[model samples]
Every structure is written in C-alpha cells, then in structure tokens.
Target: MPASDALEGIQACVFDAYGTLFDVHSAIGKHQHRLGGRADQISLLWRTKQLEYTWIRSLMGLHADFWKVTQDALDFALDRHGINDPELRADLMEAYLKLDCYPEVPEVLSMLKDGGFRLAILSNGTPAMLEAAVKNSNIEQFIEKNFSVEEVGIFKPDFRVYQIAVDGLGIRPEQIVFLSSNAWDAHGAAAFGFKVTWVNRFGQSKERLPGKPHFTIANLLELPNLLG
Candidate 1:
C-alpha cells in the first residue's frame, strides 16, 4: 500500500554497479583495437548472455558467482561473434575491471553524498572486481561502502541478496533507495520492498514485471534532482 513511500523516506541510495554506475559498453569498446570490427557486437552479446545466465540460473536453482558467469558469457559471445584468441578475453576482462563511470555519475553522487545521504554499491561482482571497477571509475569517494553478493553466495533476483544488503548495512529495506539499470532487477528490488529507481539509459520501454520502479531517469545526472 505504501510502495512509493519507500522513495519518500529514503535514507541511502544504493546502486547496481555494472550498468547503473559504470558504462558497460565503454568498457567493451575500449577493447576495440584488439577486438577489431567485432568489438561492439562482442561486448553487447557478452553482457546480454551474462545477464541471461544469471536469470536462467536463478530460475533453475543453479548458482554461479558473477565473475564466472561473466567469463562464460564472454566465452559464448566470443564464439558467436567470431573471436578466437584467449589473449583477447583477458584483455577484454581487464578492460571490464577498468570501466569508466558514466560521465554524469561522479557529480550526481557527489551531490548526494554532500547532502548527507548515504551512497553505496550493492553488486553481484566479486569484492575485488567491484573495488577495481569503482577505483577505475573514480566513484570511490562518494560511496560509503561497496557490498558484494559474493559474501552471501548468490546472485540477484533471489531476494536473499537484497536482504544481505539490508542486513549487512543495518538499514531497513525501505530506507534504502535501490538504483539499477536493469529493468528486471529494478522489478525484483521493488517487489522485495526497497525503493526502486530505474536508470533507463538505453530508453527501454517498460515491460510487465512483478513490481515497478518508483522513478525512472535517463542518467545519473538526473538522479539528485529526482531524489529531492
């Protein structure tokens, strides 16, 4: 009954790292020189399958941490996208660890932190991976914590992962505003009782999901404004 009410009393803004705070495509594109003409296709397919595997695996009750799933997805995408070099996979993954933040992210997050709202990351990434990405993107300063689901041995859409974030941070689920780039995860968080904000960077049309976001924005640039 008081669903969007989650947003009204938000105490902290927690984000999904890969697509929400970091630029996934830019990370892939950085491998363009090595990936040659297939860079874009390779990057997109890998991310696509990476997410697909997580969804299917969650549904099938098989669990893999995010890093393994990222590689498996990369393997699948490489084969389908005509890439065959083992060295290239390493290069691409190295780039993933170094993804740049969306240009607007740093400023908006700074505003949020300066305003005394808590800022944090709750990701499916390994702790090291999450840390590396955040450091590379220059987002570490604004965040108070970096939380990984790996500690709890699960990926998202499982509800338990969100609970880990809530419990680990010692915050009520309703006090945290969960920001995600993936519509499905946004749906999952909202259904699980966190405030949900969908960063619809790619202009995705809303599809039916169990629960919907309290607010949607084109980028983090608009986030601070929306929060107020």
Candidate 2:
C-alpha cells in the first residue's frame, strides 16, 4: 500500500520503544565530546550490539533484562573503541535512561490521542527502562501501557512477543497497527498479521524479510494522517 493510504480497522497503535519513540543514539550523542573522534562509531556499535544481544539471548533461551543487555553492549562498544574510562562508561549508561524523543514525537502522539486512538509501547526494554524513557520524554500521558518482552522472556521478531499486544489490547492482530523504525521489527509485526508501518527515520533501506509493511513514512509526523 502507498504511504498516503489509511489503515482501516486499527483500534490501537503499538510502537517499538527504543528507535521508534525514543532516540537510542542520543545516549552516545550526549557524550560525544568525551570520545572526540570515535563518537559516531561507538554509538553505532553500541546500538548494533544491543540489538544483536537481544536476538542471541532469545535464541539461547537465556533472557536477561534489557538494562543488562544495554550495559553489556556499551561495554563491548567501549572496549572495541579502545576507550576505557569508568566514568565515561557510567555516564553513558545513565544517559540512556533519558534519551531524547524525535522532535515530532510529542505532537504526533498528541494528535493521535486526540483523534481517539489507543496508544501503547511494545518493546524489548524492561518495564522500568521503558517507564524512565517515557517519563523522561514527558510522553507518558499519551501512552496507555508499555508492553515489555520480559513477560515472555524473548525479544522481537518472535511471534510470542508480538502477541503481547494482541492479548493486552484485547484485539485481533489485524486490528492493531504496529509501528517500528527497525526494518526487521516492522516485518515481524506484519508477519504476525498487524498492519505495519515502517517509520524510516534514518532513511534506511527495507529489509529482505518474510512480511512487508503496509506503509512507509520518513517519521512519525506522517503517522496521524496515515491512520486517519
């Protein structure tokens, strides 16, 4: 379907927390002055490893909370870049709790809520982590609930993780509209039967996966219109 098309029968809008609603790279961006030349590289690696660990742990059936995975990813990224400062490591971890939301997030969410759509977050982040990010960004009021993988002890792309929204929202998969900036995540939600929207905030290419998104938009600013 085209990006301008509206998704019918969507009772609730479920979002991917980390990259969708909140800016994951902002954690490292906040500390770029300390790293000098390696800021961008470290930020990219940290996010890569964070996501990699989630999939790996899910496969192994050895689930850890997202907070632990986040810390471990940061450790690996810091070690790889050959910058071993305990203070920097501690500061980066703390920065993650309050990562900035995309500039359009608040307005888009407010518009959607005003339009009478139910909103919630479905993410690999633990409840505490999701809570901190939402509250920190001051968008908590817009979200009705935050669904974490901790409930099922697995990460995204797993059918079970997506079911959390279906069960919690008391709606069929087709009735929920799932949004994610992560290509694989958008594909997974679509595979699970939701109308998926790939929020291509960074202009990334589409993923070669089993399911395709119904719509693709550059940012959440286009969301309300697409839903209507």
Model number with the top TM-score = 2
TM-score of each: 0.93, 0.97
**Candidate 1 structure quality by residue, lDDT tens digits, 1-228:** 444344677789999998998888876787788777877888888999998988888788788888889999999998997768888789888888898888888888889999789888988888988999988877788888888887777788779888877987788998998999999889999999998889999999996989888888888887777766
What lDDT is obtained when candidate 2 is compared to the true structure?
0.92
Q: What lDDT does each candidate get?
A: 0.85, 0.92
**Residue-wise lDDT of candidate 2 within 138-217, one digit each (tens)?**
99899999999999989999999999999999999988899999999999999999999999988997789999998889
How high is the lDDT of residue 206 in model 1? 98
RMSD of each candidate relative to the true structure? 2.1, 1.3
On a 0 to 1 TM-score scale, where does candidate 1 land against the true structure? Answer: 0.93
Which 10 consecutive residues of model 1 have the lowest summed lDDT?
Answer: 1-10
Off by over 4 Å in 2: 1-6
Error of 2 at 116 (Å): 0.5
Per-residue lDDT, model 2, residue 146, is 97
